[model samples]
Target: MEGTIVRRVIPSDNSCLFNAVGYIMEHDKHKAPELRQVIAATVASDPKKYSEAFLGKPNEEYCAWILNPEKWGGAIELSILAEYYGREIAAYDIQTTRCDLYGQGKNYQERVMLIYDGLHYDALAMSPSDGAPEEFDQTIFAVRNDRTLGPVEGLTLNLVKEQQRKRSYTDTANFTLRCGVCQIGVIGQKEAVQHAEATGHVNFQEYK
Candidate 1:
């Protein structure tokens, strides 16, 4: 049930909505009422700057979509600067969902899983445009999954116990006598010695 699709967000169409919000949020943070009025007007007018800012240019190495819009959401905007290959990238904005705003409910784990899966798919699709091949992008997803599920606790202790057990049984031929006080050679050596002593022979011709 895995699938992927690739498409670029048109700068003219997408950047306008995003940029309007960004402008309001960036410049009118202290003026909440004014910001809201401006946002409403911008959304009503449907400016082009919003979408353009999103897919416009690479200002930084990584861009993020800020989920919460009320606090920071304005159409589409940059939220954080991320480092990618030693370069900084702007963050993109996304509408915050009920789950993101208020936290998940009973199906929290499932919801989180879905979110992660979607992010992986999007990252794969955007990899090429991000200057990485699809194969390399796949590796990023694989590493993310690996680290998310990797055992972090009690690992050292488990490895130590396993190593001890491995060493203890390494030499199968070494055995303890019935008296538990002396070592015996291989099973054949013990049997040969038993036969010689039982028959009271000084030397039993060695059997090949």
Candidate 2:
């Protein structure tokens, strides 16, 4: 099987929106016929001149428009660091894979054929080899809305207060999936809170 792989990148800063758009334009210039048509149509229908038109007022709207395959062109499989103004946030990866199989064998004999009547073969024998190259294509997209005017700080103090408050009640454990296959189990709830508060750091305890 064969397929095209595409990726798009958007910066976390609004000042870079035009740059991101430019990147997409350049990519579209060399895309395959099918994808090129899609890109051209989307741009022509909704020019990126006005911020509100392409970059909606709400971060979600912009994300939905860009990632929706049906709405926008299917050229871009992933976008990264896409943000509007950093409140609502989303980060994800898109990937596609394709594979092909082939069979090879020769017919036995003219009049007399070797049937190997002494033994029988399983149906799996006719199948292709288990080893095959897996096509892997992936794209990553992250978006966040900027709400605060200035950089936020004071993480250590905030963590300490949170640990104290939680300690006042009781220790509770929490489990979170770090990624696709990793599970992080937080043990000693109070200790974990205290550690986070004191060091402003959290570590994932991994398990299968």
Candidate 3:
């Protein structure tokens, strides 16, 4: 029987993307360190592709930055991990409600899904039944068949709508943040950037 589609929320410990991918790929949430190491190795081995100009920093520096648990991952990491794992990663962005396909045109026959709400990530899976435990969840999908992907797309869109109605996201532009280093209040992403630039303090904790 078809199962219930649900979101597996990963911890927001700055490794949410890695953890989300880990959960979807291996049903393991503690693979962040290993995944980060893989990313570093992948980038280091291919300086031509992940160049300073492309990475916006020296290859070594980028690798070092990503190794830090405090750093967040996005498109670069997504693409790298997709290539490393040989699966098409479909990331559904809550803000745009759009699916960004990674590893597309690569003849990858397998696919996995994740949801990004600007600041956090979660794994998308299909459990054996409603309210079933995550151990019964299926995170992988087939991509070679168009019909096989139909229900998955529908499931992702339904999840997007569900999260939208719940307002389960932070408004990065207007969300308030307090500098953890200085305990100074800042409003919105711009102010946070300004605070970081002015005081060289990048540690911020969001507040309602």
Winning model by TM-score = 3
Give lDDT for model 3. 0.87
Q: With candidate 3 superimposed using the best TM-score fit, by how many Å does residue 90's alpha carbon deviate from the native?
A: 0.9
Q: Candidate 2 on 116-164: residue-level lDDT in tens? A: 1001100001112233222232111122142211211122123224434
Instruction: Go through the candidates in order and give each one's C-alpha lDDT.
Output: 0.25, 0.25, 0.87
lDDT of 3 by residue, 60-123 (tens): 9999999988778999999999999999899998877888989988889899999988778999
* Ordered list by TM-score, greatest first: 3, 2, 1
Candidate 1: worst 10 consecutive residues by lDDT? 113-122
Q: How close is candidate 1 to the true structure, as a TM-score?
A: 0.15
Candidate 2: regions farther than 4 A off? 1-81, 84-173, 176-194
- On lDDT, the stronger of 1 and 3 is 3
lDDT digits (tens) for residues 1-208 of candidate 1: 1322222221222122233322222321133334334444443344344344643533221122222122222212211111101111111111111112111121212101101110110110212334444342211111123222133112222333443444321221333223112322223335534643454332222211
- By TM-score, the better pick of 1 and 3 is 3
Error of 1 at 150 (Å): 38
TM-score result, candidate 2: 0.17
Q: What are the models' TM-scores?
A: 0.15, 0.17, 0.88
- Show model 1 residue runs off by greater than 4 Å: 1-29, 47-89, 92-208
Error of 1 at 127 (Å): 35
